[model samples]
Target: MSKKLRLSSLIVGDAQADRVVPPTGFTARLTLFAAGAMAFLTVFALALSLASGRLAARWGAELAQSSTLRISAPAEQVGAQTAAALAVLESTPGVASARALSAEEQRGLLAPWFGPDLPIDSLPIPQLVEIVETEEGYDVAGLRLRLQAEVPGAVLDDHTRWRRPLERAAARLRLLGLVSIGLIGAAIAAMITLAANAALAANSQVISVLRLIGAQDHYIASAFVRRFTLRALSGAFVGTAIGALAIFLMPSAQEDGGFLTGLGFEGAGWFSLLLIPIVAAVVAYFATGSAARRTLSELT
Candidate 1:
């Protein structure tokens, strides 16, 4: 009761008390290493989340706005079917434009498989017509029915077969990134709690002396909280800086134009990384406070 009154007085009287707990090197290093490691992993998780989001948006927008038409028929009927498919697409309400791909364009698409010197004219390859949709988009079922009725050889493909899988993959990647972040937070909390427990165990004499000298539980806990929180903040800062530098050094998106290689921050994403240290500090503060209070309460 006397200790509580003294603590209340310390708060209300705005008086500073002398530090009662001596710091241990082990807990300091442990907290620093744990916070730094977690923060480093968190940076990569954040990058994965942001990059997957961008990929999802790009795939949705690009794939949703366009479709393809493949016309397979006899040499004489290929041109007529292509024309008929174009007419059907043009008269459609939601379609923005439909143009048959030229021979050169078709040959270029097939070049990887058939080689550049392969004679495109000798082969009876299907004619491909690209279809662009308006902002409102087109009725895919209705367009397919119209194409079947007008041109039997014409097949309208909305690219749904390919787009759905890509979208699902991107969504799963984003979810994985989020799960990683949650796991990282849990790891940080657990590590900080262990470090706090170790510190409390090592300074049993110091805690007993403070209690014998009329120190409140909050006072003792606050000492541990402040020390661990500052350590976590400093460690997270260093880790975040190193992670950001590593991300910056990664290959640019323009270099290879690959999704996995372009894993890094963009625009406001860089600013979001600044919150990592603050979050680490808060986590440390709460984790250490809880552990310290529990340890102190268990003492005589």
Candidate 2:
């Protein structure tokens, strides 16, 4: 539309209107600082959201496909119950594989709590069996019933208690990260709006002179919108770059390092960071435009 083209031209460069707003001032610095700081925070928030999502998926998939069986019996019956549990699991439909952990493996599991030198044999440690499930996963209730009848000491743990809580925690963390990003965006908009209002108020004398010279309100407002939007875009770009660099320089994720060690983008995830500046620009466009128009109307 003709109106759209005219507006775009004004934003692109209206030499006459560009002079209306001072090129550098306190408002300019405020808009730049707010956008930059918020964009930096937005990057971290996005990283946290992505990391939490991956963590949730991993916990859901890994835990759902696996479970544990603990056998607590008199020293004489421990081996018998463990063997019986393993046999039951092997015969169960939908079981992919099952194995009774060796004494050494069990010692490794307990080493963190009891120390490596602690003699595992001296303790009445319950035998543990690891079970992996097929895509159609074994029926937990049925499996429990079978273990009860054949292996009296066997207790089946489908990891339901552990999995549900972990998944819920990861999901809630992801939600919180997303909410943080939204709040950051709103904060940026608020800051830009305030800066725009301040800039407009400071230039009322110039605006009055321009109005006397027949400058349309839309043309005057467009100059302020374009300037503030560009400032936001540039500031956000710088902030995003710095934040991403900081993330990249962080220690690489190691399998042993756990979730906290991997709080950064992975592969395609880096591309998502590029949107931060663009989003900031759009937020500024609307915010500054609204503030400019309102301030201009009040001035008249």
Candidate 3:
């Protein structure tokens, strides 16, 4: 349409048209700094969103298919109860597999709090059993009833109480991250609009002369729009690069590091970062153009 043509012509601007806007000033600095700062924050917001999403999916997948069983009884009865519980689980319709944890494995779990040198054998620790579920999953109520009847010491923890809250928290964190990005974009647009207005006001004399020479309002507005848009694009590119570098330098994802270390781009996720600068430019284009047109109309 005519609007696109006007924008395109302004982008491939004439030297004379470009001269109307100052090459360097407060407005230029404001636009660049605003775009850069917002873009930098946006990168982190994007990372947080993606990381939380991955975390939620991982938690859902892992927890959905697995559970734990604890057997607490007198030292002499522990082994008997564990065997009874295993027998019950093995016959359960939806359970895929169940294994009692070795004393070494249980010791490893307690080591973080109890220390590596703690004498696990001397303590009356509860027996732990890991349970993996079939695709259809086990009937929790039925399994719990069976354990209660066959093995009084056995306790089934499907992780429902634990997993639901963690998954919900991760999902909300992802939502918050997305909301932060939207707010950042709005902040960028507001800053660019103010900068455009200031630049237009300062160049009122130049605008008058251009008008007197029969330059159309659209042509005059395009120059300002194009300048601000390019400034936003350039600044955003720099900020995004620095942000990505910072993320790249962070600790690599590891089991020990958990969620914090994994807050970064992985594989194809890196490619999405490239879109930030382009989005910033488009936002600046619309913001500056609207500001310029409104200011010019008022001047007339």
lDDT of 1 by residue, 39-120 (tens): 9999999999989988887889899899999999999999888888888889999899999999999999999998999898
| Candidate with the larger TM-score of 1 and 2 | 1
* Candidate 2 per-residue lDDT over residues 100-172, each given as its tens digit: 9999999999899989998889889999999999999989999999999999988889988988989999999
Question: Could you tell me how far off, in angstroms, the CA of residue 156 lies in candidate 3 after the best superposition?
Answer: 3.0
Angstrom error of the Cα, residue 177, model 3: value is: 2.9
For every candidate in turn, the CA RMSD to the true structure comes to 4.4, 3.7, 4.0
Task: State model 1's lDDT.
Answer: 0.86
**TM of each candidate vs. truth:** 0.82, 0.79, 0.76
- Candidate 2 runs further than 4 Å off: 1-22, 72-88, 91-93, 102-127, 145-153, 210-215
Give candidate 3 misplaced runs (Cα > 4 Å). 10-16, 19-22, 70-94, 100-129, 134-155
Of candidate 1, the 10-residue stretch with the lowest lDDT total is: 9-18
Q: Write the per-residue lDDT of candidate 3 for residues 225-274, one digit (tens) a residue.
A: 88988899999988899999999999788874688888999889899899
Candidate models: Cα lDDT each: 0.86, 0.88, 0.89
